[model samples]
Target: MAIYFYGCVTMDGYLADSQHRIDWLHQVGSVEDTGYDDFYKKMNVTIMGKRTFEEIQNLPDVEKFYQATENYVFTHEKELKVKNYQAVEENVLDFISKIDKDKNVFVIGGNSLIAPLLDADLFDHLIIQIAPVILGKGIPLFTQSEFQRFYHLDQVRQFGQFAELVFSRKAPLDLPIS
Candidate 1:
């Protein structure tokens, strides 16, 4: 019941800069101490893409996520509206398998929707919150899928000094089929 993949990366991995500006996370310091408002109060569902939901719809009190959560917008563009919008634009893995798998989805990103959900492995965890500053290039936080994925690093919370890393997705070994 956890299909996570939160964000923030930049030690050299890049998550935005060469025009995909994030403004350095509000010039670094106090994203509510990086708990992100307690991870949006333990999210109930949030998936983005369509340029990170139009960069959170050009934030400036975008009604603060319409109070609490529930927003999926993958987009292929077709009058993409937003009230508390929902327009996946057809079969993104069957619109993420019809959501509501007991809630707690969250895939938030813009690498073309995390490159087809990490090549259909369908994610599990990848909290990530490095952010130190180093954009030798930009808009890259995993998206060239050739499939060699294997994570399993669990937690590592550091805060203010940054370092959140938390991965998990290493299963599928009994080699002999291809």
Candidate 2:
């Protein structure tokens, strides 16, 4: 499966403010103005943390927002309010490994969720849209990890006030046999 991460971060590389609010993202531009719609169309499934799910549950017609994809929310809660989303309590890596290989999985948010996957080098593509604003202190997109993973810049595009950077995991080098 191709695991993808698509989200907006501040120039300083923060996903949200200190309060874990994405209000800054709305102030800069709307989702319609960005390439989100096009990117969302290709995904077959979505995975997100409880906080990320809660953040979006307040939206209008939230039930239908991700109707197209099989949504999985990693939470300790016994049940989820949304019938469409399945509540998962297992390890993110283990849970993701069970998904069909042909599916396109989109990771919504939560640095906690992304960090482990990134560290394990399971993320296939990262599409980060860099917003112009910079919040000095906030929840950063990347946290300290032991190992480093490399990616190649696939493409760059401007979406109004946001600059989208598309990166794909670098392929392993084929060494010559002596």
Candidate 3:
């Protein structure tokens, strides 16, 4: 099973503005029109940051996900509660690794959730939507520094002016040890 992340970013690479505003995103393209629907459908489990969970609560269909047995929000705020979301403060990877191997997991982010996973090299794939506009300052898609990594372009698709970039992590090739 593949554990991946999917979100729309600006041309300059931002998921939201300084104030955590994604209004600019809706100005250019909508979630339904974009490839998000298809990407979300394939995901059986969800792992997201607390800020992201807070942001998503405003969505009309947030209640729909309460049915999932595996919906987690990584946060230190033990008091933070969002209906059915399980608050996880332990090691993110340890929590993630325990999920059913048969299910495909989606790491939904406001950038905070995926940073450590990216650092630990736990993610297998990353699918990003590049919106047409740019936010000079905002939350970045990847928040890690000094962590070297590589990926192979798996696919690319266009939705209106937005571009969907799919990348699969390039596992290091095994070599002779002798």
Could you say which candidate leads in TM-score?
A: 2
Which lDDT tens digits does candidate 3 get at residues 1-178?
6789888889999988988877898799677677776677778888888777878778887777645546888888775545778788988878877888888888888576678888888788899989888789999888975766878889999988789999998868732234
Off by over 4 Å in 1: 1-6, 9-24, 27-48, 56-73, 79-88, 94-121, 124-127, 130-151, 154-160, 172-178
Where model 2 places Cα greater than 4 Å from the true spot, the runs are: 174-178
Q: Against the true structure, what is each candidate's TM-score?
A: 0.31, 0.95, 0.86
Instruction: Looking at model 1, report the run of 10 residues with the lowest lDDT sum.
Output: 169-178
**Which of the two, 2 or 3, has more lDDT?**
2
Per-residue CA lDDT of model 1 for 71-150, tens digit only, reads 77878776565677576777566777887777777777777777788888888888889878887888888875696777
Of the candidates numbered 1 and 3, which has the greater TM-score value? 3
| Overall local distance difference test of candidate 3 | 0.80
Compared with the true structure, what per-residue lDDT tens digits does model 2 show for residues 23-97?
999999999988999899999999998988988988888998888899999999978987689999999999998
lDDT of each: 0.76, 0.92, 0.80
The residue-level lDDT of candidate 1 at 116 comes to 82
Deviating ranges (above 4 Å) for candidate 3: 65-69, 79-81, 174-178
Ranked by lDDT, the better of candidates 1 and 2 is 2
